[model samples]
Target: MSAPKPSKRPIRSYVIRSGRLTDSQRRALDEHWQDYVIDYEPSALDWNALYPQQQPLTVEIGFGMGDSLLAMASAQSDCNFLGIEVHRPGVGKLMHGAHQAELTNLKLMCHDAVEVLEHCFEKESIDRVLVFFPDPWHKKRHHKRRIIQPAFVSLISSKLKTGACLHLATDWQPYAEHMLEVLEQEPTLINHCGPGKFWDEPERPATKFEQRGKRLGHGVWDLLFRKE
Candidate 1:
Protein backbone atom coordinates (compact mmCIF):
# COMPACT_ATOMS: atom_id res chain seq x y z
CA MET A 1 0.00 0.00 0.00
CA SER A 2 1.14 3.52 -0.73
CA ALA A 3 2.13 5.73 2.22
CA PRO A 4 -0.43 8.28 3.29
CA LYS A 5 0.15 11.69 1.75
CA PRO A 6 0.79 14.66 4.03
CA SER A 7 -1.96 17.21 4.16
CA LYS A 8 -0.98 20.68 3.05
CA ARG A 9 -1.51 23.50 5.49
CA PRO A 10 -2.95 26.70 4.12
CA ILE A 11 -0.85 29.85 4.30
CA ARG A 12 -2.44 32.58 6.40
CA SER A 13 -1.54 36.25 6.55
CA TYR A 14 -1.83 36.46 10.33
CA VAL A 15 -1.00 34.39 13.37
CA ILE A 16 -3.14 34.84 16.49
CA ARG A 17 -1.01 35.84 19.42
CA SER A 18 -1.95 34.71 22.93
CA GLY A 19 -2.23 38.21 24.35
CA ARG A 20 -3.98 38.41 27.70
CA LEU A 21 -7.06 40.59 27.88
CA THR A 22 -7.58 43.24 30.50
CA ASP A 23 -10.57 43.17 32.87
CA SER A 24 -12.42 45.85 30.93
CA GLN A 25 -11.71 44.12 27.64
CA ARG A 26 -12.97 40.81 28.98
CA ARG A 27 -16.08 42.44 30.41
CA ALA A 28 -16.82 44.24 27.17
CA LEU A 29 -16.41 41.05 25.17
CA ASP A 30 -18.80 39.14 27.40
CA GLU A 31 -21.46 41.83 27.83
CA HIS A 32 -21.32 44.29 24.92
CA TRP A 33 -20.46 41.96 22.03
CA GLN A 34 -23.96 41.89 20.58
CA ASP A 35 -24.22 45.67 20.71
CA TYR A 36 -21.18 46.38 18.54
CA VAL A 37 -19.90 43.14 17.02
CA ILE A 38 -21.23 41.31 13.99
CA ASP A 39 -21.09 37.57 13.52
CA TYR A 40 -19.37 36.56 10.32
CA GLU A 41 -21.58 34.97 7.70
CA PRO A 42 -20.87 33.82 4.16
CA SER A 43 -23.60 36.02 2.72
CA ALA A 44 -23.05 39.63 1.78
CA LEU A 45 -24.03 42.16 4.44
CA ASP A 46 -26.87 44.60 3.92
CA TRP A 47 -25.47 48.02 4.67
CA ASN A 48 -28.91 49.65 4.69
CA ALA A 49 -29.96 47.49 7.61
CA LEU A 50 -26.56 47.61 9.36
CA TYR A 51 -26.21 51.37 9.72
CA PRO A 52 -28.81 53.81 11.02
CA GLN A 53 -28.68 55.82 7.81
CA GLN A 54 -27.15 55.56 4.37
CA GLN A 55 -23.52 56.70 4.37
CA PRO A 56 -20.21 55.95 2.72
CA LEU A 57 -18.74 52.72 4.10
CA THR A 58 -15.11 52.22 5.04
CA VAL A 59 -13.66 48.84 5.95
CA GLU A 60 -10.51 48.67 8.04
CA ILE A 61 -8.50 45.44 8.19
CA GLY A 62 -6.46 44.44 11.25
CA PHE A 63 -7.25 47.30 13.59
CA GLY A 64 -4.74 46.59 16.35
CA MET A 65 -5.98 47.54 19.85
CA GLY A 66 -8.66 49.62 18.05
CA ASP A 67 -7.05 52.98 18.83
CA SER A 68 -6.92 54.39 15.33
CA LEU A 69 -10.25 52.90 14.31
CA LEU A 70 -11.96 54.37 17.34
CA ALA A 71 -10.45 57.77 16.60
CA MET A 72 -11.49 57.59 12.96
CA ALA A 73 -15.06 56.62 13.81
CA SER A 74 -15.32 59.37 16.37
CA ALA A 75 -13.86 61.97 14.02
CA GLN A 76 -15.72 60.93 10.88
CA SER A 77 -19.30 60.75 12.04
CA ASP A 78 -20.59 61.05 8.48
CA CYS A 79 -18.96 57.78 7.39
CA ASN A 80 -19.77 54.26 8.51
CA PHE A 81 -16.80 52.18 9.68
CA LEU A 82 -16.51 48.39 9.69
CA GLY A 83 -13.40 47.05 11.38
CA ILE A 84 -12.20 43.44 10.96
CA GLU A 85 -9.80 42.07 13.53
CA VAL A 86 -9.00 38.53 14.61
CA HIS A 87 -7.88 39.46 18.12
CA ARG A 88 -10.67 39.28 20.65
CA PRO A 89 -9.13 41.86 22.99
CA GLY A 90 -8.91 44.48 20.27
CA VAL A 91 -12.56 43.90 19.36
CA GLY A 92 -13.54 44.16 22.99
CA LYS A 93 -11.66 47.42 23.52
CA LEU A 94 -13.18 48.97 20.43
CA MET A 95 -16.62 47.84 21.54
CA HIS A 96 -16.13 49.37 24.98
CA GLY A 97 -15.08 52.68 23.47
CA ALA A 98 -17.90 52.72 20.93
CA HIS A 99 -20.42 51.90 23.60
CA GLN A 100 -19.09 54.61 25.88
CA ALA A 101 -19.13 57.21 23.12
CA GLU A 102 -22.63 56.15 21.99
CA LEU A 103 -21.33 55.70 18.48
CA THR A 104 -23.95 54.62 15.93
CA ASN A 105 -21.72 54.27 12.89
CA LEU A 106 -19.11 51.76 14.05
CA LYS A 107 -19.25 47.96 13.88
CA LEU A 108 -16.67 45.24 14.24
CA MET A 109 -15.92 41.65 13.25
CA CYS A 110 -13.49 39.26 14.85
CA HIS A 111 -12.58 37.08 11.91
CA ASP A 112 -10.09 36.59 9.14
CA ALA A 113 -10.21 39.77 7.03
CA VAL A 114 -9.55 38.01 3.76
CA GLU A 115 -12.50 35.72 4.26
CA VAL A 116 -14.66 38.61 5.43
CA LEU A 117 -13.81 40.67 2.35
CA GLU A 118 -14.25 37.79 -0.07
CA HIS A 119 -17.56 36.55 1.33
CA CYS A 120 -19.42 39.26 3.23
CA PHE A 121 -18.84 42.29 1.01
CA GLU A 122 -20.26 42.62 -2.50
CA LYS A 123 -18.19 43.65 -5.49
CA GLU A 124 -18.04 47.42 -6.10
CA SER A 125 -19.86 48.08 -2.83
CA ILE A 126 -17.17 49.54 -0.62
CA ASP A 127 -16.16 53.21 -0.68
CA ARG A 128 -12.75 52.79 0.90
CA VAL A 129 -10.50 50.02 2.20
CA LEU A 130 -7.81 50.75 4.78
CA VAL A 131 -4.95 48.46 5.74
CA PHE A 132 -2.64 50.25 8.14
CA PHE A 133 0.51 48.79 9.67
CA PRO A 134 -0.19 45.16 8.86
CA ASP A 135 2.28 42.50 9.97
CA PRO A 136 5.31 42.60 7.68
CA TRP A 137 6.23 38.92 8.16
CA HIS A 138 9.82 40.10 7.85
CA LYS A 139 11.63 36.85 7.19
CA LYS A 140 12.45 36.09 3.57
CA ARG A 141 10.94 32.60 3.71
CA HIS A 142 7.77 33.98 5.31
CA HIS A 143 7.09 36.53 2.61
CA LYS A 144 4.25 34.36 1.36
CA ARG A 145 2.48 35.03 4.64
CA ARG A 146 2.36 38.79 3.98
CA ILE A 147 -1.14 40.13 3.26
CA ILE A 148 -0.13 42.74 0.70
CA GLN A 149 0.24 40.37 -2.22
CA PRO A 150 -0.97 40.64 -5.79
CA ALA A 151 -4.05 38.45 -5.37
CA PHE A 152 -5.20 40.27 -2.24
CA VAL A 153 -4.75 43.67 -3.91
CA SER A 154 -6.82 42.50 -6.84
CA LEU A 155 -9.50 41.30 -4.46
CA ILE A 156 -9.53 44.69 -2.73
CA SER A 157 -9.64 46.51 -6.03
CA SER A 158 -12.63 44.46 -7.18
CA LYS A 159 -14.60 45.31 -4.03
CA LEU A 160 -13.99 49.04 -4.31
CA LYS A 161 -16.48 51.25 -6.11
CA THR A 162 -15.40 53.35 -9.05
CA GLY A 163 -13.35 56.36 -7.85
CA ALA A 164 -13.09 54.85 -4.38
CA CYS A 165 -9.75 54.68 -2.59
CA LEU A 166 -7.58 51.89 -1.18
CA HIS A 167 -5.11 53.26 1.33
CA LEU A 168 -2.19 51.22 2.66
CA ALA A 169 0.47 52.27 5.15
CA THR A 170 3.56 50.50 6.39
CA ASP A 171 6.63 51.43 8.42
CA TRP A 172 8.91 48.72 7.04
CA GLN A 173 10.66 50.02 3.94
CA PRO A 174 11.01 46.56 2.37
CA TYR A 175 7.35 45.77 2.99
CA ALA A 176 6.36 49.16 1.61
CA GLU A 177 8.29 48.42 -1.57
CA HIS A 178 6.63 45.01 -1.81
CA MET A 179 3.21 46.61 -1.36
CA LEU A 180 3.91 49.24 -4.01
CA GLU A 181 5.04 46.62 -6.48
CA VAL A 182 1.96 44.46 -5.90
CA LEU A 183 -0.46 47.43 -5.98
CA GLU A 184 1.04 48.86 -9.17
CA GLN A 185 0.51 45.59 -10.97
CA GLU A 186 -3.21 45.57 -10.31
CA PRO A 187 -4.95 46.88 -13.40
CA THR A 188 -8.06 48.06 -11.57
CA LEU A 189 -6.22 50.52 -9.34
CA ILE A 190 -4.50 53.82 -10.11
CA ASN A 191 -1.95 55.24 -7.69
CA HIS A 192 -3.08 58.58 -6.31
CA CYS A 193 0.50 59.80 -5.88
CA GLY A 194 1.47 58.95 -9.46
CA PRO A 195 3.67 56.00 -10.49
CA GLY A 196 6.31 54.70 -8.08
CA LYS A 197 5.75 57.56 -5.64
CA PHE A 198 4.54 57.42 -2.02
CA TRP A 199 1.93 59.72 -0.52
CA ASP A 200 3.81 62.55 1.21
CA GLU A 201 0.87 64.20 2.90
CA PRO A 202 -1.31 61.61 4.61
CA GLU A 203 -4.59 62.96 5.94
CA ARG A 204 -5.47 59.96 8.08
CA PRO A 205 -4.94 60.07 11.84
CA ALA A 206 -1.69 58.58 13.09
CA THR A 207 -1.89 55.07 14.54
CA LYS A 208 -0.24 53.79 17.70
CA PHE A 209 2.07 51.57 15.65
CA GLU A 210 2.99 54.51 13.44
CA GLN A 211 3.87 56.63 16.46
CA ARG A 212 6.07 53.91 17.89
CA GLY A 213 7.80 53.41 14.56
CA LYS A 214 8.40 57.17 14.24
CA ARG A 215 10.02 57.34 17.68
CA LEU A 216 12.39 54.60 16.52
CA GLY A 217 13.28 56.69 13.44
CA HIS A 218 11.58 54.36 10.99
CA GLY A 219 10.38 55.79 7.70
CA VAL A 220 6.69 55.42 6.88
CA TRP A 221 5.13 54.95 3.44
CA ASP A 222 1.53 55.54 2.44
CA LEU A 223 0.10 54.26 -0.82
CA LEU A 224 -3.26 55.55 -2.00
CA PHE A 225 -4.84 53.88 -5.01
CA ARG A 226 -8.16 54.71 -6.60
CA LYS A 227 -10.32 52.17 -8.37
CA GLU A 228 -11.03 52.86 -12.01
Candidate 2:
Protein backbone atom coordinates (compact mmCIF):
# COMPACT_ATOMS: atom_id res chain seq x y z
CA MET A 1 0.00 0.00 0.00
CA SER A 2 1.16 3.51 -0.78
CA ALA A 3 2.16 5.67 2.18
CA PRO A 4 -0.37 8.35 3.19
CA LYS A 5 0.44 11.75 1.75
CA PRO A 6 1.16 14.56 4.14
CA SER A 7 -1.39 17.34 4.27
CA LYS A 8 -0.02 20.70 3.26
CA ARG A 9 -0.25 23.49 5.79
CA PRO A 10 -1.31 26.84 4.39
CA ILE A 11 1.17 29.75 4.59
CA ARG A 12 -0.28 32.54 6.69
CA SER A 13 0.80 36.14 7.01
CA TYR A 14 0.25 36.15 10.79
CA VAL A 15 0.61 33.74 13.68
CA ILE A 16 -2.10 33.80 16.35
CA ARG A 17 -0.54 35.16 19.51
CA SER A 18 -1.91 34.12 22.87
CA GLY A 19 -2.60 37.58 24.18
CA ARG A 20 -4.52 37.50 27.45
CA LEU A 21 -7.81 39.36 27.51
CA THR A 22 -8.66 41.72 30.34
CA ASP A 23 -11.95 41.45 32.26
CA SER A 24 -13.62 44.30 30.42
CA GLN A 25 -12.49 42.96 27.07
CA ARG A 26 -13.86 39.52 27.86
CA ARG A 27 -17.12 40.96 29.09
CA ALA A 28 -17.43 43.13 26.01
CA LEU A 29 -17.01 40.09 23.78
CA ASP A 30 -19.61 38.12 25.71
CA GLU A 31 -22.18 40.90 25.92
CA HIS A 32 -21.87 43.33 23.01
CA TRP A 33 -20.55 41.02 20.26
CA GLN A 34 -23.91 40.49 18.60
CA ASP A 35 -24.53 44.20 18.43
CA TYR A 36 -21.37 45.19 16.52
CA VAL A 37 -19.66 42.05 15.30
CA ILE A 38 -20.35 40.20 12.04
CA ASP A 39 -19.67 36.48 12.04
CA TYR A 40 -17.64 35.40 9.06
CA GLU A 41 -19.39 33.35 6.36
CA PRO A 42 -18.19 32.25 2.95
CA SER A 43 -20.62 34.52 1.11
CA ALA A 44 -20.90 38.14 0.06
CA LEU A 45 -22.30 40.48 2.75
CA ASP A 46 -25.37 42.61 2.14
CA TRP A 47 -24.20 46.09 3.15
CA ASN A 48 -27.67 47.57 2.89
CA ALA A 49 -28.93 45.14 5.51
CA LEU A 50 -25.85 45.54 7.65
CA TYR A 51 -26.03 49.30 8.02
CA PRO A 52 -29.13 51.44 8.62
CA GLN A 53 -28.23 53.80 5.80
CA GLN A 54 -26.40 53.25 2.53
CA GLN A 55 -22.99 54.92 2.50
CA PRO A 56 -19.43 54.50 1.27
CA LEU A 57 -17.66 51.46 2.72
CA THR A 58 -14.19 51.47 4.24
CA VAL A 59 -12.54 48.23 5.33
CA GLU A 60 -9.53 48.19 7.65
CA ILE A 61 -7.51 44.97 7.88
CA GLY A 62 -5.77 43.91 11.11
CA PHE A 63 -6.87 46.75 13.33
CA GLY A 64 -4.62 46.04 16.31
CA MET A 65 -6.38 47.11 19.54
CA GLY A 66 -8.84 48.94 17.19
CA ASP A 67 -7.99 52.41 18.52
CA SER A 68 -7.33 53.95 15.10
CA LEU A 69 -10.37 52.28 13.52
CA LEU A 70 -12.61 53.50 16.32
CA ALA A 71 -11.27 57.02 15.92
CA MET A 72 -11.92 56.95 12.19
CA ALA A 73 -15.44 55.57 12.62
CA SER A 74 -16.20 58.21 15.22
CA ALA A 75 -14.85 60.99 13.01
CA GLN A 76 -16.31 59.83 9.73
CA SER A 77 -20.02 59.55 10.40
CA ASP A 78 -20.74 59.84 6.68
CA CYS A 79 -18.86 56.63 5.87
CA ASN A 80 -19.47 53.09 7.03
CA PHE A 81 -16.51 51.12 8.40
CA LEU A 82 -15.76 47.41 8.65
CA GLY A 83 -12.74 46.30 10.63
CA ILE A 84 -11.14 42.85 10.34
CA GLU A 85 -8.95 41.52 13.13
CA VAL A 86 -8.04 38.11 14.52
CA HIS A 87 -7.23 39.25 18.04
CA ARG A 88 -10.11 38.77 20.45
CA PRO A 89 -9.07 41.51 22.85
CA GLY A 90 -8.80 44.07 20.08
CA VAL A 91 -12.20 43.13 18.70
CA GLY A 92 -13.70 43.33 22.16
CA LYS A 93 -12.14 46.72 22.84
CA LEU A 94 -13.42 48.08 19.54
CA MET A 95 -16.91 46.69 20.18
CA HIS A 96 -16.88 48.16 23.67
CA GLY A 97 -15.92 51.56 22.31
CA ALA A 98 -18.48 51.37 19.52
CA HIS A 99 -21.24 50.48 21.96
CA GLN A 100 -20.30 53.33 24.29
CA ALA A 101 -20.14 55.80 21.40
CA GLU A 102 -23.39 54.38 19.94
CA LEU A 103 -21.70 54.18 16.59
CA THR A 104 -24.16 52.91 14.00
CA ASN A 105 -21.70 53.11 11.11
CA LEU A 106 -19.16 50.58 12.35
CA LYS A 107 -19.01 46.78 12.34
CA LEU A 108 -16.24 44.24 12.84
CA MET A 109 -15.22 40.71 11.86
CA CYS A 110 -12.80 38.37 13.55
CA HIS A 111 -11.22 36.31 10.78
CA ASP A 112 -8.34 35.93 8.40
CA ALA A 113 -8.50 39.01 6.22
CA VAL A 114 -7.36 37.27 3.04
CA GLU A 115 -10.16 34.73 3.20
CA VAL A 116 -12.69 37.37 4.19
CA LEU A 117 -11.75 39.57 1.25
CA GLU A 118 -11.92 36.64 -1.17
CA HIS A 119 -15.27 35.29 0.01
CA CYS A 120 -17.38 37.86 1.83
CA PHE A 121 -16.81 40.99 -0.24
CA GLU A 122 -18.04 41.54 -3.79
CA LYS A 123 -15.84 42.83 -6.59
CA GLU A 124 -15.82 46.64 -6.81
CA SER A 125 -17.78 46.83 -3.57
CA ILE A 126 -15.23 48.56 -1.33
CA ASP A 127 -14.72 52.30 -1.57
CA ARG A 128 -11.51 52.29 0.51
CA VAL A 129 -9.15 49.68 1.97
CA LEU A 130 -6.71 50.42 4.78
CA VAL A 131 -3.76 48.19 5.69
CA PHE A 132 -1.70 49.73 8.45
CA PHE A 133 1.50 48.22 9.85
CA PRO A 134 0.89 44.57 9.03
CA ASP A 135 3.37 42.05 10.37
CA PRO A 136 6.65 42.81 8.58
CA TRP A 137 7.93 39.22 8.50
CA HIS A 138 11.40 40.74 8.40
CA LYS A 139 13.33 37.55 7.87
CA LYS A 140 14.35 36.91 4.28
CA ARG A 141 12.95 33.37 4.25
CA HIS A 142 9.65 34.63 5.66
CA HIS A 143 9.23 37.27 3.00
CA LYS A 144 6.81 34.95 1.24
CA ARG A 145 4.58 35.19 4.30
CA ARG A 146 4.29 38.96 3.98
CA ILE A 147 0.76 40.00 2.94
CA ILE A 148 1.98 42.60 0.41
CA GLN A 149 2.62 40.17 -2.42
CA PRO A 150 1.66 40.57 -6.06
CA ALA A 151 -1.31 38.18 -5.94
CA PHE A 152 -2.72 39.82 -2.80
CA VAL A 153 -2.38 43.33 -4.23
CA SER A 154 -4.10 42.18 -7.41
CA LEU A 155 -6.93 40.75 -5.35
CA ILE A 156 -7.26 44.06 -3.47
CA SER A 157 -7.31 45.95 -6.77
CA SER A 158 -10.13 43.78 -8.08
CA LYS A 159 -12.25 44.37 -4.97
CA LEU A 160 -11.90 48.16 -5.17
CA LYS A 161 -14.43 50.30 -7.02
CA THR A 162 -13.22 52.44 -9.86
CA GLY A 163 -11.34 55.42 -8.38
CA ALA A 164 -11.42 53.83 -4.94
CA CYS A 165 -8.26 54.09 -2.83
CA LEU A 166 -5.92 51.64 -1.09
CA HIS A 167 -3.82 53.07 1.73
CA LEU A 168 -0.86 51.12 3.15
CA ALA A 169 1.55 52.18 5.88
CA THR A 170 4.55 50.40 7.30
CA ASP A 171 7.32 51.26 9.73
CA TRP A 172 9.76 48.85 8.14
CA GLN A 173 11.49 50.43 5.17
CA PRO A 174 12.18 47.12 3.44
CA TYR A 175 8.53 46.06 3.70
CA ALA A 176 7.45 49.50 2.54
CA GLU A 177 9.63 49.16 -0.53
CA HIS A 178 8.24 45.70 -1.13
CA MET A 179 4.68 47.05 -0.83
CA LEU A 180 5.40 49.89 -3.24
CA GLU A 181 6.90 47.49 -5.74
CA VAL A 182 4.04 45.03 -5.49
CA LEU A 183 1.38 47.75 -5.74
CA GLU A 184 3.09 49.42 -8.69
CA GLN A 185 3.21 46.13 -10.55
CA GLU A 186 -0.58 45.76 -10.38
CA PRO A 187 -1.88 47.14 -13.69
CA THR A 188 -5.26 48.02 -12.27
CA LEU A 189 -3.88 50.30 -9.53
CA ILE A 190 -2.37 53.74 -9.96
CA ASN A 191 -0.28 55.41 -7.29
CA HIS A 192 -2.05 58.49 -6.01
CA CYS A 193 1.23 60.15 -5.01
CA GLY A 194 2.74 59.41 -8.43
CA PRO A 195 4.97 56.49 -9.39
CA GLY A 196 7.76 55.44 -7.01
CA LYS A 197 6.74 57.98 -4.36
CA PHE A 198 5.16 57.87 -0.92
CA TRP A 199 2.41 60.02 0.57
CA ASP A 200 3.79 63.12 2.32
CA GLU A 201 0.73 64.19 4.26
CA PRO A 202 -0.89 62.28 7.10
CA GLU A 203 -4.13 61.02 5.60
CA ARG A 204 -5.45 59.32 8.73
CA PRO A 205 -5.19 59.71 12.48
CA ALA A 206 -2.18 58.02 14.02
CA THR A 207 -2.76 54.75 15.81
CA LYS A 208 -1.36 53.95 19.24
CA PHE A 209 1.16 51.55 17.78
CA GLU A 210 2.22 54.15 15.25
CA GLN A 211 2.71 56.73 17.97
CA ARG A 212 4.79 54.30 19.98
CA GLY A 213 6.88 53.45 16.94
CA LYS A 214 7.44 57.13 16.28
CA ARG A 215 8.57 57.62 19.86
CA LEU A 216 11.08 54.84 19.32
CA GLY A 217 12.54 56.87 16.41
CA HIS A 218 10.96 54.80 13.69
CA GLY A 219 10.15 56.29 10.32
CA VAL A 220 6.88 55.47 8.62
CA TRP A 221 6.18 55.12 4.91
CA ASP A 222 2.71 55.63 3.48
CA LEU A 223 1.52 54.58 0.03
CA LEU A 224 -1.76 55.55 -1.54
CA PHE A 225 -2.97 53.77 -4.67
CA ARG A 226 -6.24 54.05 -6.54
CA LYS A 227 -7.99 51.38 -8.55
CA GLU A 228 -8.03 52.32 -12.21
Per-residue C-alpha lDDT of model 2 across residues 152-176, encoded as one tens digit per residue = 8998889999999999999899999
Assess each prediction's global lDDT (C-alpha) against the native: 0.93, 0.93
In every candidate, how many clashes are there? 0, 0
| lDDT of model 2 at position 228 | 93
Q: What is the per-residue lDDT of model 1 for residues 1-228, given as tens digits with 9 covering 90 to 100?
A: 999998797689988988899999999999989888899998898876898979999999999888999999999999999999998888888998998999999999999998999999889999999999999998999999999989889998898999999999999999999999999999999999999999999879999899999999999999999999
lDDT of 1 at 222: 96
- Runs off by more than 4 Å, candidate 1: 1-6
Error of 1 at 90 (Å): 0.9
The global Cα lDDT (0 to 1) of model 2 is 0.93
What TM-score does model 2 achieve against the real structure? 0.96
**Model 2 Cα displacement at 15 (Å)?**
1.0
